[model samples]
Target: MKRQYLFSAFLAREKCLLYYQGTIRYVVVTADSGERIQLGLKHFQPYFSALGLRGRFRLTLTETGAFDSLEQIN
Candidate 1:
């Protein structure tokens, strides 16, 4: 089974990296409520070029509450 969540965030400009579970290319963002989110480039490749640093978007999180996809909101 899997779960999905929706939230708004702003892409962070500061370079940050995570090697969690043997994965890299993670992008860090700040949630609307001030929570920091780490999104992986592997999952966000399609939207990568479209979303600039500090860009705002509505995130669709896959299982484990890790963002799977996104739609630009601003």
Candidate 2:
């Protein structure tokens, strides 16, 4: 079944590409339902830094549902 969720997250880490000087972003988020969702930055764009990967923010997503707008919570 499909569902919507609101969660808090941090830019946990990034994987460096050997060929390109870019990154594959990742985040660790604790959902409002107390579930953890770790994923890549296919849809998110949070500011990242070595000492600031733990920036806490909030986002919303729909799993197999509608793709609505996501927001960052302060």
Candidate 3:
């Protein structure tokens, strides 16, 4: 079963990638749109929620792309 989640993110430079359990999956944003990043959290919701992550998550941009470190805020 695959689940999809849509959420907004703030990237360092608008370009980023999505990582699930140390594996990169989706590219969230691009350098041209360096403001806000929208992520399509697909098929990895269970893994993400398992780590107690829900709602909006923070993203950090690196040379590769944007990644969620699974840090949740209440």
> How close is every model to the real structure, measured as TM-score?
0.46, 0.44, 0.28
Off by over 4 Å in 1: 1-24, 50-54, 62-68
- What's the TM for model 3? 0.28
**Selected candidate, larger TM-score, 2 vs 3:** 2
Full-model lDDT for every candidate: 0.52, 0.51, 0.40
The top-ranked prediction according to lDDT is 1
Clash number for every model? 0, 0, 3
- Between candidates 1 and 3, the one scoring higher on TM-score is 1
RMSD of each: 5.9, 4.6, 12.6
How far out, in Å, is residue 46 in model 1?
2.2
Q: Please give, for residues 1-63, the per-residue lDDT of candidate 3 as tens digits.
A: 222233433432112233544455543533333554544555325435333333444344454
How far does residue 15 in candidate 1 sit from its true spot (Å)? 7.7
Q: Assess the local accuracy of residue 41 in candidate 2 as a C-alpha lDDT between 0 and 100.
A: 58
Model 1 poorest 10 in a row by lDDT: 12-21
User: Over the stretch 8-53, how does candidate 2's per-residue lDDT look in tens digits?
Assistant: 5544344323112444455456778798776555546444445334
The segments of candidate 3 whose C-alpha lies over 4 angstroms from its true place after superposition are 1-34, 47-56
